[model samples]
Every structure is written in structure tokens, then in C-alpha cells.
Target: MAKDHGPTVKDDKLYEDLLRDGASKGKAARIANAKAAGTLDHRSSELEDRSKADLLKEAREIGVAGRSKMDKAALVKAIRMG
Candidate 1:
């Protein structure tokens, strides 16, 4: 008989906890990391590599405060430091 093989995976609760704390591009990256670790869904990985402007746009969508007045670099920093 053939042996069964299963996919590798990571903890899902950690990712969810981070997300519940805040909604931002940083959270998106956490989700991406979980996906890479085979835990969360692989949807935001591309977002992890996006440019500052693009990241800011995504952060805006996630409803980061003061985003509309922030510059691209500031947005990236806020998102990453959140």
C-alpha cells in the first residue's frame, strides 16, 4: 500500500490575532507570510512585494487613519510599523 502525504502548514490563530489587532498593509503581509508557511490562503503575497504607492493604496483600502494626508513613504512606514 502507498503511504499518504500531507501538505506542510503553520499556525492559523497567530495570523488571525494579528489581523484582529489592526487592518493595514502590514496585516496583509502577515497573512502572506502565513500563506507562505501554508497556513492562511495565498492571496496577499503579491501585496508584500508591492511599491510604496501601491502599498499605500492597499493600506487606504484597509482603512488606516490619516492615510489620505500621508505621503507614500509615510504610508509604507505606518503600514509596516503597525
Candidate 2:
């Protein structure tokens, strides 16, 4: 059975699964909440389909440093690795 993670954890089973999958606490919580709310997007756009500007914007949003110096391919790699 999944251990109780307090009220902040909306979905205990999802949280436990995420934890077992090596997800950080915050990431697990966000995913669990999103799943519970039916807002979790399982599908993502292909990296090649995204524009350089869009990749850069996402990198910036995710706090990827030196994104200004990276090209589209580099941004894609960094975003994936991040």
C-alpha cells in the first residue's frame, strides 16, 4: 500500500508510482494533481516540430541557463535532458 503523503498529496497511488519512478517530490505532486484534475497532457509535441523561438521560450521557462546562446537542436537536447 502507498503511504499517506498528507493532504497536499491529492493522489496517493499516483504519488507513490511517481516516487518509485524517481520523480522528485514537487514533480510528483504536480503530476499527481494534474492527473487528478484531468489536466495532465500525456501527448507532447515532437522536438523537431517546435520552432527555435518556441524551444528557447520553453528553456527559459524551465530555467535552462545560457539558452540565448543555444541553437534549436541544442535547446531541444537541453530541454530533454532537463
Model number with the top lDDT: 2
Against the true structure, whose TM-score is highest?
Answer: 2
Alpha-carbon runs more than 4 Å astray in model 2? 45-82
**Candidate 2, residue 16: CA error in Å?**
1.2
Per-residue lDDT of 34-81 in model 2, one digit per residue for the tens?
A: 788897654456977878887887677567899999988899988766
Candidate 1: deviation at residue 30, Å? 6.8
- Report clashes for each candidate as comma-separated counts: 0, 0
How displaced is residue 54 in candidate 1, in Å? Answer: 1.1
Candidate 1 residue 2 C-alpha distance from true site, Å = 26
How many pairs of residues collide in model 2?
Answer: 0
RMSD of 2: 3.5
lDDT tens digits by residue: candidate 1, 1-82: 3122123213344444555667553564555455556755333555445676677766765568988788767776776665
Runs off by more than 4 Å, candidate 1: 1-52
Against the true structure, what is each candidate's TM-score? 0.40, 0.57
